[model samples]
Structure formats: structure tokens, C-alpha cells
Target: MGVRIQMLVALTSLLALFPSLTVTVAVMSVDLGSEWMKMAIVKPGVPMEIVLNRESRRKTPTVVCLKENERLFGDSALGVSVKNPKTVYRHLQSLLGKKHDNLQVKVYQRCFPEHQLQGHPVRGTVYFNSSLETHYSPEELLGMMLNYSRGLAQDFAEQPIKDTVITVPAFLTRQSEGQSCMLHRWQV
Candidate 1:
């Protein structure tokens, strides 16, 4: 976090030298991990800091539980998952972009054994049969998580975060990386 702050400070200083130019920007970086995800921001006028979740934690559990009509994320979702595992989705980064029958996804399914994993007959990607009997693709679930992360970052920065760099697992296929809105982004 300090590393980005150094560069951001320089940018702000340059702006100070030139009072005629007005520019404001904030960049967020996300580490999309299987077990936990972290977020940080580089915004002018303040030191770069890790974005905190609702619980004010540095890192949030990579979990989401859709219980009936209510939705939960991070620690709250993990707590609900303990009782209603079927409504919870975990290891989202690991499952994204992999074939439904891929060995890695198979291991995840066998290890978790909470939600029912099935392959889309056409897409051949993995989707979970939630407790509500809704079929949710990994990409869709990940999008929810990313949206949640975006909210956290935006709230912390106190402004809209337009440019974000999300770091993905090295093992993810190109398709998985492409699934997100990353036309001008990359993993790591």
C-alpha cells in the first residue's frame, strides 16, 4: 500500500505545482483469492490504504450466501454458510473459467460437498444449484463478489472507482480472465 502512495504523492505534488490543471482519480486493486480477498486504493489527497469491509477488516472471506431473498457477503456469509451451506458459494476464484468436469473443480466439489455442482450442457462451465433451486454460474457469482468489492472500495475512497486492477490466479484459463470486464486489465 505504501508503494502506491509514494507514486500517488508525487502525482499530487505535480498537480500542486500546476494549479491550473485539475485532475482527480483513484485506482483500486483487488486480490481475488479462493479463501479471502483484499482491496486497496490509491487516491490523491490521502494515503493509500486497504479498503475495509463492513466489519472493518483488512481482508474479507471470499464467500457469499444467498439465503432466500436476502444476500450476504464476506464474514456474514461465512457465518450463515455454517448452518446453510447450500446457500453459500466459496472458492469462487478457483472455480471460474474451468471446465465443469475439470480435475481442479472436481477436487473443489469433493472437498466442499455443500452445493451441487453441474455443468451447462452448452457452455460446459460449472454452475451451482443453490438452496433456492437457482442455477448460478461461477462467473455470475464472481460478478456479485466483484460488485461487492467495488462497493467497499467506493465507500472507502468516498468516490467512484473507475479503474481497477484485479489480480487473478495464475492457473486461471484465458477464458476465465476474459469473463470479467477486463478489456484493459490483466492478472497480477
Candidate 2:
């Protein structure tokens, strides 16, 4: 009983010292990289904690698979890449906001020759071509990934986490492309 009282007093003192540490709701942050994505969550009475995926991994591969009518994300999608190279999309962060003629897009094309990538007829930007005969823009693909990450965060928090912050790769931010989505005003 004495230890419990002391612990409560310490917690109260700590909360008084750092008011922000007393979080009442859960919030999540995602680091969306080219090869992997990591998520962290902050909840009441807890410090920032890495949100693990279903596989209990701190990070998830940044890959998505779109086959027929089904779509897969992360490792599940990566697992199917060897069998269906044309349907699985990898390193999508590199393709984000790139033009069809951009040097980066050229590099992406060379990296994944198995999949067909074409310029959007109107946007003149990169669009992925899969066996589904449907074209998906990088923005759409990134949105799907963000959604996937949200699911992971939600599962870990065990509550609906509506507040989320997503950050892109450093290279993406330091790129010379000015006509791209830098996410300065974009909110998750």
C-alpha cells in the first residue's frame, strides 16, 4: 500500500512536470519510406511506442499487390511478387509525384521492367500498368499505402486513431522536382 501511494505520487509529479506526457487519446505517426514503413503511436500514460504489424515486426515492406479483384499490402504483397511480378508494385514512393519523362521515372522504369508503366494521358505523369488492364497513379497507390498503415495503427492502438502524421523519405523532400506533392499543405 505504501509503494502504490508512492508510485501514484511520482506519476502525479511527472504529469505535472510534463503535461504533454499525459496523453488522453492515441495518435500515430508513419514514416513512409521507399523500402519500408514504420509506425509509432502515443497513447495515454504511454511514451511513444512503435506500432508493430500483424507479423509483430516494427516495419513493413513498402509493396502492394493488385491482382484481379483483390489487393494486398506489405509482406503479403511482397510474397506474391515472385509469382506475379507484373501485378505487384514495389518502391512506389520513388514513383510518387514523378512525371513520365522525369529522370527518376526513367530509373524506376529500368528498375522494374517486368511491369508496364506509362504516362497519364492527361496528367502526363507516371501510371502503373498491371495485368488488371487498369492504370493506377502514384498518388492513388500512396493513398492505398497510407490506408494500409492506418489499419496497422488502428489494430495496435485498439481504438480508432483518426489523428495521424505521415512523413516521406528525405530524398523525396530534398528532390529538385518543384511540381510534385511535397505534402507541405497535405494532411493525413
Candidate 3:
């Protein structure tokens, strides 16, 4: 009984001294890739842990499906790609900030016929066309994937997540780098 009372008093004193102290349980690191994306979380005094999506996979397909009023991502989006090709956007990272006539964009279009790409007024911006006649900007499409990744990290950590470090290729061009920064800013 005496020990318990002493511990309680000590905790109370600490709380009083640092009433606004907030403990962060985890930090997330995301590898955003054209073909796949992966997330890992690190907590103080613990080894880094990979966070899996609903499909129980460490890496998720970088795909998004736009419906009339909602969006689906990862495996769910890939599953609907065949039936709803026009509405499913994939290879977001590769297409981001690339002009519609870019060689890489042309290659992607040839490789993935299910989706259509269009040019935006911005020099390196591209848009995806959906069945609803809605055009999704590269940033918006990548944002959806990032948001979904954040959700996975939150779910795995069992806590609210607010920050992440995304990994991009070092060989990206200036335009690509700018677009990547724009995406990061949107997450913030």
C-alpha cells in the first residue's frame, strides 16, 4: 500500500512538471514506387516493423479506382482494373509530373491500355480519365494512395499517424522532383 501511494505521487509530480508532454509511439516510412509501395513503422526502443495492407501484403499495388462518389486503392483497385479499366489509374509515380507526350508516358500508355492519360496546362502534369468523365490529376491520384498508406500505418500501430517520410528515386528529373515535392506537401 505504501509503495503504491509513493508511485502515484511520483507520477502525479511528473505529470504536473510536464503536463503537455505527448509521447509518440511510432513513425512511418513509405517507399512510393511506380510498380508497388511499401510502408514500415519504427517506434522508440523497438525494431522497425513493416505494415501490411488489408490483403496481408507488405507491398501494395500502386493503383487507384475512382467510382462515381468513392475511391478504392491497392488490391481492391487492382481487382477492379480489368472490369473498370477506364476508372482505374495505375503507375501513378511514373506518370506524375510527366507531359502527355513524354516518352515514358507514351510507354506507360502502351503497357496499360485500361487507363487513359491526358495533358494538363502545366508543363509536366498529366490527368487520368474515369468513366464518370472525371479527370484526376497525378497529385490527386497519388494523394489517394498516400492517404491509404497512412491509414495502413495507423491501423498497424494502433495509433493516430500524422507524419511520414516517403522515398523516391534519386535519378528523377527536375520536373519529377518538383512533382514529388508537391505530393509530399499535400500530405503535410
For all predicted structures, in order, the TM-scores are: 0.80, 0.77, 0.77
Q: Each prediction's Cα lDDT score?
A: 0.82, 0.77, 0.77
Give the per-residue lDDT of model 1 (tens digit) for 1-188. 99999999999999888766656878899988878999999999888789999999999998888887888899999899778888888888788867777898889988888778888889887888763557888887777788788889999998888887878778766577567545333233
Give candidate 2 misplaced runs (Cα > 4 Å): 1-24, 131-133, 173-186
- Considering TM-score, which of the candidate structures 1 and 2 is the better prediction for this target? 1
As for candidate 1, its clashing pairs are none
Ranking by lDDT: 1, 3, 2
At residue 139, give the lDDT of candidate 1: 80
Model 1 scores worst on lDDT over the 10 consecutive residues at 179-188
Query: Candidate 3 has what TM-score?
Result: 0.77
lDDT of 2 by residue, 12-106 (tens): 99888875744466888988778999999988778899989878999899888888889899999989988988888888777766778889888
Native-referenced Cα lDDT, model 3: 0.77
Q: Better model by lDDT, 1 or 3? A: 1
